[model samples]
Target: MRQIDPAFTGQPTNSKAHKAVDPAPTRWQYRMERLWLTPMFRAMIRTGIPSFGFVFLFTWYINDPVRIAAMIDWYEGAVSAVQDRPEFMVSLLRIEGASEDLQDDIQEALPIDLPLSQFRLDMGELRSLLVDLDPVLDAEVRVKSGGVLLLRVTERTPAVAWSYDDGIEILDATGQRVATLSDIESAGGLPLIAGEGAEKNVPEALTLIAAASPINDRLIGLARIGNRRWDVVLTGDQRIALPEDAPAAALDRALAMNAAKDVLARDVRVVDLRLPGRPILRLSQPARAELKRLQDLERLSLVNTEGTQ
Candidate 1:
């Protein structure tokens, strides 16, 4: 046998004589320490865990279509509840610059019912409907404070009453139609115009009527002759032919002659002013005979005077 060392001998060793031995780390703990030192592992712990949790929640939420639809419905209902409050509701419609009839028509054309929320009303569509009326020139729609739907309109004004084969049409100053009437007599004091394209020449016709104001009350109507000239008709079915050019001047001249010579009051059927230089008069049968008789008497008086000399 080999010689036994004193440390291996089964004798009491001094407490401070042996060196202290350190405990070795286990395999799993050593591996965990190494992983914590890596940059990729540290980055995954910092960012990857939160990302995975968010993705899991998102997938769970999207998997149920009915729940998503119910959430949307709840959101819409909340919005609608806020919008349908009494403060935002339109209970009355206030119309300015419109007649009673036009107001009725506007009410008829409205797309929404009264006592409804203003949030549901489309102002552009409302304005378009109001503008479609013949008399409405322009329309403006707005919501005012105190829950009022304000509609301000500009209406066409009737300037003349036109009479054609169909009926009477009321026209504005711009020759635009305002309304239609069954007869010219029902159009109040507005001057009557007849024949095609007469409404377009209303300004000239009005000028002519103004020029002949002295006999205006006795005037019956004005006619557009072949769409070129005007014929001023009097109460007794007498017609004054007007020249296409300088008609207002010719009318003034004719009225001046009538004031001095009583030309119009005489038994004349037609006063022909188509010729600028010469004015011709067509007399009734009785007036023609009387004129012939007067001429014969003047000639007889001249012959008797010559014979006596």
Candidate 2:
């Protein structure tokens, strides 16, 4: 038996009939197929989508204020737990090279409480605070291994006592102000300097004081004159005014004169050493009047002798 042609039915067959076309995909389907073939789209599917989903869920979890507060509290609690460990605690403070009075000042100045965490201490700031004190020349601060806060301080040594119009202040060798004293005698045998700008010329004053050692028993102090020169004030109001340049040499010269002639013991008010070659002795009021009276008597005698001759 012959097979029947499905295209040609038992009815009329028209030669002019068009062939049936194969079905095409929809626009959305075609676009989806094209997108699937792209490498960027595949990468987005592999990584971007999962990352976005994770971030969205995370954001939702943390969006609540209560959850944020809980997270912050948990972080702070963890930090506090680490900081409060026994091994990291500073329970003792040891001060070295500081005097008893300085220790008291340091203790009063420190803004920390004992038995604190080492992590909470600011070493640099503490050292700066210690050095800021007038008596403290230098300082070191460190935390030892066995929970000790160690402080090493170097105190300024008082070299001279500066007495100005206001008050007296103790100065170190470098002329740094150390402390205030009630009086010049409280400086404890340190050389005394007086008047304005005396503190700045401490070295010069000390030199003069050294040079005047021979007459130290009669020396009172060195006074700064016009912030340029010094006047060595001795007992009985005798002043030896020294020049600005090589004042130590001029002081030495005056000291030599006093030693040789016993000039300072006389009725002298000032020994002017401003000129290196020439020394002027300014006598007291009584000595000046007496000298004037003797000069008048000598002149009267000379006049009377000339008239008689």
Score residue 88 of candidate 2 by CA lDDT: 98
Q: lDDT at 238 for candidate 1?
A: 89
lDDT of 1: 0.89
lDDT of 2 by residue, 117-216 (tens): 9989999999999999999999999999999999999999998889887898999878998998887667887778888888998888888888899998
Taking all chains together, each candidate's TM-score versus the true structure is 0.70, 0.80
Can you list the residue pairs that collide in candidate 1? none
Q: Supply the global lDDT for candidate 2.
A: 0.91
Worst 10 residues of 1 by lDDT: 13-22
| Candidate 2: clashing residue pairs, number | 0
Residue pairs clashing in model 2 are none
